[model samples]
Target chain A: MIQKKICMLGGFAVGKTSLVRRFVSNVFSDQYQTTIGVTVEKKCVTVASQEIMMVLWDLYGEDEFQHVRDLYLRGSSGYIVVMDGTRKDTLQTALALQQTAANTVGPVPFVSIINKADMRSEWEIDEHVIEQLRDRSWTVLFGSAKLGQGVDELFLNLATQMVQRPPLSNTHP
Target chain B: MSSDSGRSLPNSPTSEGFTSREEDWTQLRTLLLAPEQTQLDELRERLDHRMVHSQEVSQVLPEAIAIRGVGDQQLSNALTPYVENGFIAAVRKSPRAIVDAIAPIMGPAIRQAIARALQSMTQSLNRSLDESLSIRGLRWRLEAWRTGRPFAEVVLVHTLRYRVEQVFLIHRETGLLLHHVATDAAVVQDQHVISGMLTAIQDYVRDSFGASPDQTLDQVEVGEWTVWIEQGSQAYLACVIRGTPPASLREDVHDALAHIHALHANALADFAGDATPFKATQPYLESCLLAHYERPPKQGALKGWILIGLIVLGVVWWGWMAYQAQSRWSHLLDRLREEPGIVITQARSMWGDYHIEGLRDPLAKAPTALVIEAGLNPATVKMEWAPFYALDAPLVLARAQSILRPPESVQFHIEGGILVATGSASPDWAREAKRLAVLVPGISQYRDDGLVTASISALLDRINRTVIHFPSGSSTVEPSERVALDTVAAILRELDQLVSQSSQRVHLEVLGWTDATGPPARNLQLSQERAEAVVAVLREKRLDKAATVVLGSVRPLDQGGSNQESANQRVATLRATLTAQGQDSQTADP
Candidate 1:
C-alpha cells in the first residue's frame, strides 16, 4: 500500500473542506480549521490497481488577512487548488496559493478545481482562463461540492498522477 | 638550464633530430617527474581500491569509535543496532553457545532472581494470608463490594506507587502510530488518531507558546494520569502513567524511545503508513509499561494479631466453662453413687448433657434436687428412677416412720430389722407402733424397750401417794375418810384404764396401822377391822383393783411423842403397781 500526502489549498470559502466532506465524510469538524488552520482527512483510492492512501491536509482557506503556513506543505506529494467560479477574486487567490504550494513542496502533481459548478449560470470566471491554465500543462477541472460533481475525479486524478510519476525529491521536505 | 643539465637531457630539441624530438621531450618529461609521478599514482591507486582503504579504516575504527563515544552518544547510537542485531543473530544461530558463554554470569543472576522471586512470593503470600482474614482485609472487601471493584484492585489502588498504563511509539513527522503496547486493563482507543491528536496538541502548544522545536511538551497531566512523552530523533515515546511516577521513569521512557530508534532506525526514518515493521518494537514499548505496588502496611498484620488474640481469649473462656460444667457433672455423679437408696444402673454424659438411670426408693433423695444443688441446669440432666425397696438402715427407718406414722416424741430406727422405738411416747402410740412395726417390709420385730410410756407412770404415782386416816377406836367411815377413799377409787380406775391396752393389770394395796397405847391383841383386831372397813368402803364404791393389808401392835406406823402421831397411824395408804392380768393381787402386795 502506498500513502501520499495531499494538501488542499484555496481562497477562503472556496469549498475546499466542502469538496473533501462531499467526497468522504471521514474528516474532522470545521472547528479544527478555525483553530489549527488545518484538518487532516484520509481517503483510499486505487490507481492502476494499486491501493494508494491519500492523507489530505485540508488547510484553512487563504485570505487577505490570513495566509496558509508553509510549514503545512512540507510533506505533500500532491495538492489540489480550489476556487469559487462565482468570485473572480477567489480564482486569483487560488492561483496565488498554487504558486506558494509549488514553491514550498516543489513541482509535484496538482489539479486546479473551479468549485460551485452547479451555479455555472452565476459564475464570473470564464472558460478562457481555465483553457489557458490547461494550455500551461496544468490540470484544470470543474467541480461542485454542493452537487457532488467531479469531487471523486478531482482527488483520484491527483492520486493517479502521484502514483505514476516518480517523486524528484524525498517524500518529506 | 645549465649546459651540463642540457647534455643529460637526451630528448632536447637541439640535440636530437626533429622527428624524434617529441618522443625525446616526452622521455625527458617522464625522466624528470617519474619518481613524483609514481608516488602520485600509488596514492591514486590506494584511493581507487576500497579494500586497501578499508584496511586502513579498520586500523583506526575502534579508536575512532572509542573517541567518538567518549565525545558524545552518536557513536553508540550508530552502533547499538549493529550490536543488537549481532547479538540476536548469535542467539538465534546457537542459543546454547550464547547461554554457555554467559552461564557463569547468568547463573548467579538467575539464582538470585529466583531466590528473590521466591522470597517475594513467600512474603506476598504471607501478607495476603495474614490480611485475608484481618479487619483491614474485611474493610477492603467491603470497599470492593461497595465500589463494585475487585478486592485486588481495591488493594492495588491503596498500595500503588506508579503504573504506566499505556505506551505509544508514534511517528514524529506524520503523527501516525508506529506501534503501541498497554497494560492488560488499559482502555485502548484508535491509536493512530490518538497519536495524531497528541502530536497536534504538542504542535499547538509549540505554535501557541512560540516555543522552540527542541522544547517539546514533555508531560501532560489530566487528573490522576500523566502522559510522559520522550522525544527521539525519528520517533517519540508517550506513556500514560497513573500515580506519581518517579524521576527514573522518565529516564526509562527516554531509554526505551532511544532503543526503539536504534533498533528500527530505517523503519522509522522511512515510515509512510505501513506500521508492520515497527511491530517488533512492542517489547521496547512494553518495557515502558511498568507498574509498582508498595507492600501492604504492617497494620494488617497487627490487625491479624488482634483477631488471633480475641480468638484465643474466646477459646480460653469456652474451655473454662466446659471444665466447670464437667466438674459439676462429675460431682453430681459421685453424689448419686454415694447415695444409699439410689442404685445407679447407668450414667453417662453426651454432648454436654447427662443421662442417668437408677433404682431409687421412694424415700431417697431426688436426683433433680441434686442437680440443682450441684449448680447445674436441671434440663441438662435426664434422670430415670425406678421404684425399689432398700434394706439400708435409713430407708428402713424412713419406711417404718412412713408406715407407723409415729408421733414426734418417738424416734424409730431399724437395728438388724428390729424396729427400735426410742424417746417417750403415749402408751396408745407405743401400742400402735408395736403393731405396725412388725408389718413393715424390713422389720422382723418391734422393740419398744427403750421407749417409756408416759401415762402408765403417772397413774402409778397417783395411786401410791393416796392415803386415808382412821380414829383410834372407830372402825366406821367418816366424811374426810370418804373423800380420801373417793380419791383412791379414782386413782385405781385410771390405773386400770392405763393397763387395759396391753397384757398388764393395775393392783392396789390398802395398809392399816394402829397406835401403841393398847394391848397388842386388841390393837391387832382394831387394825384388822380398820383395814376391813377401808376395803368395805372401796368395795361399796365398786373399786376392785385393791388388796387389803393390816399392821397391828407388832408394827408401829410412827414413832412420835405426840397424840397427833397416834391419829396419823390410824390411816390407810394406797399403793398401785403393774402386774400380769392373772397375778394374785393379795400375793403381790408389799
Candidate 2:
C-alpha cells in the first residue's frame, strides 16, 4: 500500500480545517476556533481497485503562519489549497499558499478547493477562475464541508495520483 | 480679707468648684491647641495597616474576592459603649461640654494628636472626594444615593451639619436658630451667666442700629430668637441667634443674640483656619449645602435649538462628503469610458490569450460581418461604439487571423475593389482566412465557400448558420435559429427604437436572386428560395410582413459583368418604405 501526505492550506477562517474534518471524520464544525498549529488525520481510500492511504495535514490557516507551511508540506506528496467560495481574497491567499507549497515540495501535485459550495449565490469563485487554473493543469474542485459534498472524491482522486507517483525524495515514511 | 468686705466665708465645695472651673478653662485652652492628636495618630496607623492588608489581600485573592471595608453598622456597634458612657460625645454637643469632658479624659497631647489625625483624615477624605467626584462619578453616586441609603453615610451626615450652620449665619441678623440638635435632655447649670451674656449682646446690637431698646424687640424663643429694627419695610435688619438666654429679658436678649451671631459669623469668615461656620448646625448642614449649590433648571427651547443646529450641521457635512465622493467616482468612471481600447488592452495583458474572443484589427473588410465580428477578442474589445454591421465581418476576420494561421496555397480574385477568395484548408486555416479577410480594408461582404476537407464536424457550424431564419412577421425565429436570430432580433429592436419616429409608416421589401450556374427553371427556384429566406426574416421582425414580398430574379438574366458584379446582383435587399399618411411620403434606408 502506498501512503500520501497531503496538506490543506489557506487563510484564517477559510474552512481548511473543516474540509479535512469533512473528509476524514465526516463531520463539520461551524464554530471557527483558530487552529493553534497543525492537525493530522488519516483515511484509506480505494480507487481503480488499488488501496491508497491519505495522511491529510490540516495546517493553521493564517497569513502569519504561512512561514511554517513549508515544514508541513515537506513530507507531502500533494496539497489541496482551500479557499472560501464567498471570499475572493481567500482564493488569492490560497493561490499564494499553493505556489509556496509547490516551491517547497518540488512540483508536488495540487488542487484548488473552493469550499462552502452550498453558498453558490454568494460565491465569489467564478467559472473563469476554474478555467484559468485548469488551463494551468491544476484541478479545481468546488465543495461544501457542511453538506459533506465532494469532500471524499477530492481526497480519493489525490490519493490515487499519489500512489501512481511518489513524492520527491527525502520524504519521511 | 473676707471679714472687711462683709461677705460670708465660701464653703469648701464651692471653692473647689471654682478652682476646678479655672483648671477646666486652662485644660480647654491646651486641648484646643492639640485636640484629637492621639486619635489621629491611631487612625493614621490603622489606615496604614488597612491599606497594607488590603494590598496583601488583593495580591493573595482573586479580583472578585477582595474585601472592601467594615460597614457603618459594625463600626457603630463597636463604638456604642464608649458613646453611652459619654466618652465619645455625639457631634451635637455644645462647645462647653466638648471642651470640659473630652479634654480632661483624652489629655492635651492625646487631644492634639486626635485633632491632627482628624484634620489629616479630613484632608485625605477631601482629596479623595475631589478626585472621585468627577461629573460621571457624581452622577452615579447621586443616582445610588437617591435609589438606596447614601453609600457615604458618615460623610453625608458631617456635610449636612456644616451646611445648616452656614445657612444660619446667612440669616444671622434675624436672631433665629436656623438649625440645631440637642446634645443632652437636661439644661446646663450656668443659666444666669448665659442670660447676662444675652443682655450685653442685645445692647450692643441696639447701639449699632441706633434703635430704642423696646422698639427693636421682635419674636423670642428658647435658645434662639429674631429681632427687627424699623428701617424701610424690606430694608429692616433681622437677626437670628442660637444658644440659651433668659425669657424675662428675651427682647433685650434677642438684640444681643443677633449681635453675637453676626459677630461670630463675620469672625468665622475672617478666620483662616480650616473650621467652617457651617459646622455649627451639626447633622442638617450638609443637606442645606446641597440645596444651596443645586443647579437651576435648564431652558427647554435653548437646548432644543442647540440640538437642531448640531444635527443640521452634521447632515450638511455628510451630504457634502457624499456629494464629493460620488463626483470623484463618476469622474473615474468617465475617465475609464473615454479610453475603451486601453481598458480592453489592459485586461488582455493581465489575463493573457484566454477568453478574449475577437482579438483582431478593426480595419478588416468582410461580408456576413456579423458572424466574423463575433470572433473578435471579447476581452480586448469594449462595448463602447454602436456597432455598424459593415465593420463586423472585417473585425471578426482580423480576430481569427490572430488565433489561426492560413494555408500558403490560398489565392484571391479582386474585381472592382471586391476580393473573392477560396481554398481547401484545415478548419483552423479557414478560420484564419476569414480573420485575414476581415483585416482587409473596403471589403464589404464575404462568402465561406472554402472546404475543410479534414473535419466534417468543423464545417457543421457554418452549415447551421446559413440554413437558419425567422418564422414570420414576429421578429422571433423558428426553434432552429433561436440563439442566433435572438441576437440579431435584439439588435434590430434597438435599431427600430433608435430611428426617427415621425416618418409615418415604414415598409420593408424583400428581394432574392440566385447564381447563373444552374438551368433557367432551377435558377428561378433557387432565387425564389433566396427571396423567401429574406422575406421570412422580415416577417419575423414584425416589420410590415405584408409589404415584405419575395421578388425572385433568376441569376443569368440579372447577372452583372464579373463574378463580383454577378454576386452583387444575386444579393437579397430589404428596403424600408416610409408613408406619411396625411402628409407627403418620406423614404429612409437603414
Interface root-mean-square deviation, each candidate: 9.0, 47.3
lDDT of 1 by residue, B224-263 (tens): 7899999998788889998889999888888888888888
DockQ list for all candidates: 0.06, 0.00
Model 2 chain B, poorest ten-residue lDDT window? B162-171
* lDDT for residue B10 in candidate 2, whole number 0-100: 35
TM-score of each: 0.45, 0.22
Off by over 4 Å in 2: A64-68, A171-173, B1-590
Query: In candidate 1, which residue ranges exceed 4 Å CA deviation?
Result: A11-18, A21-38, A63-65, A85-89, A117-125, A132-137, A144-147, A171-173, B1-160, B263-277, B294-590
Ten-residue stretch with the least lDDT total in model 1 chain B: B545-554
- The DockQ-derived docking category for candidate 1 is incorrect
Clashing pairs in 1: none
Worst 10 residues of 2 chain A by lDDT: A164-173
Error of 2 at A98 (Å): 1.1
Docking class of 2: incorrect
Q: Say which candidate scores most in lDDT.
A: 1
